[model samples]
Target: MEKDTYKTLAAPGEETLFKEKNSKFFGYAYPVNSEDEVKAVLEELRKQHNQARHWCYAWQLGTEHIQYRANDDGEPNNSAGMPIYGQIQSFDVTNVLVVVVRYFGGVKLGVGGLISAYRTSAQMALEASEIIEKTIDVHFTLQFGYQNMNKVMRVIKEKNLDIVSQKMEMDCEIVVATRKNNAPTVLEALQNLYEIEVKTS
Candidate 1:
């Protein structure tokens, strides 16, 4: 079995915000998820920071299969969104959104400076909060006789596997929920211990 892939989230129903200041630009970046959600967030941030010059953004959605978008907004072409998007990609994150709000500080920052500001702001925001990769949820069912139930249960316990559901009839049937990557190992271990039926769902 191959390792399951997932993206990282900053926190549960929480967002990370960061601010950076250069001689020419003041920037704020937010790391988020979902296009509609990030758009709403950008609107709110724009409203809150009405004086800002530009609100640029980027987002990556879906699982290992992903969809992505970036917007320069009013900044130089590819300055804001591209850099922010690069940072998120560098971290191999998916299902994430980033918006960089720029407040012009009266001086003109060249394209390089603009890119640096957006990238730094996003990286900082991600670093400030705990980012955890998502896990793929998979379930497996194991069936064995009463004679093997105790030993199998012990092994399951030792593995700290999540018991999603259980059924007991003439024999004992157990259902385990865990990441897809771990399911094969779990099933192999159980099979080694005794005659058991394993099904992945």
Candidate 2:
């Protein structure tokens, strides 16, 4: 299966503030590929919004099959993070993160107002940035003996294939990572020179 790719920007290295009414929303958005990156961004947002009333966030990650999470961060359940997450989904994007900071406007925007504000903030930030889609890479493992190691390695290097991992057993096991669209070509090239086992990861 060919994987899809998308591009997103990272959060500002420094904090940025957006205001509506008396409330100040400090926020930052970043591109994330895995749970660890999402968690790191959430932690950074928490730290940046330490003095604010709430730190809410949402993220979408993966290629064909993606996962997402949202947190209201102490605000009325579903009022903060959900709205921001909705915006992310609406954009049909993956591997993206959005954090919204609320300072409390003194005048509550009510549920509707909160939702609108957060959604708009997230949408605007995404719109202001650039996004690109590319092909996602897939990994395959090839096992062969020392006799064919040099030939296999040469093909990988010449084709600019990613060598994700390697191990030596009775036969050498090499894990190669390449774009899904290129898998067939890569496999054919390898099989021509040596016996190879291809597996997806």
Query: Could you report the Cα RMSD, in angstroms, for every candidate shown?
Result: 5.5, 3.1
How accurate locally, in lDDT, is each candidate?
A: 0.72, 0.77
| Candidate 1 per-residue C-alpha lDDT over 1-201 given as tens digits, one digit per residue, 9 for 90 to 100 | 565867676552234444444332333334456677777777887888798778777788876567888899888899888988898888777777666666666677789978888888767655554567767767778888888788878987977788988888888888887777776777677667758888877
How many backbone clashes does every candidate have? 1, 0
Residue 88, model 1: Cα distance from true site in angstroms: 0.5
Candidate 2: C-alpha lDDT:
0.77
The reply for model 2, stretches above 4 Å from the true place, is 1-3, 10-15, 127-130, 157-160, 165-173
Clashing pairs in 1: 32-97
Winner by TM-score: 2
* Native-to-model Cα distance after best TM-score fit, residue 47 in candidate 2, in Å: 2.5
lDDT of 2 by residue, 5-90 (tens): 55555433234566788888765667777889878877776685677888788888877677888988888889889988997788
Q: Which stretches of candidate 1 lie over 4 Å from their true place?
A: 12-33, 138-178, 182-201
- Against the hidden reference, what TM-scores do the models get? 0.63, 0.79
Best lDDT among the predictions, by candidate number: 2
- Cα lDDT for residue 104, model 1? 69
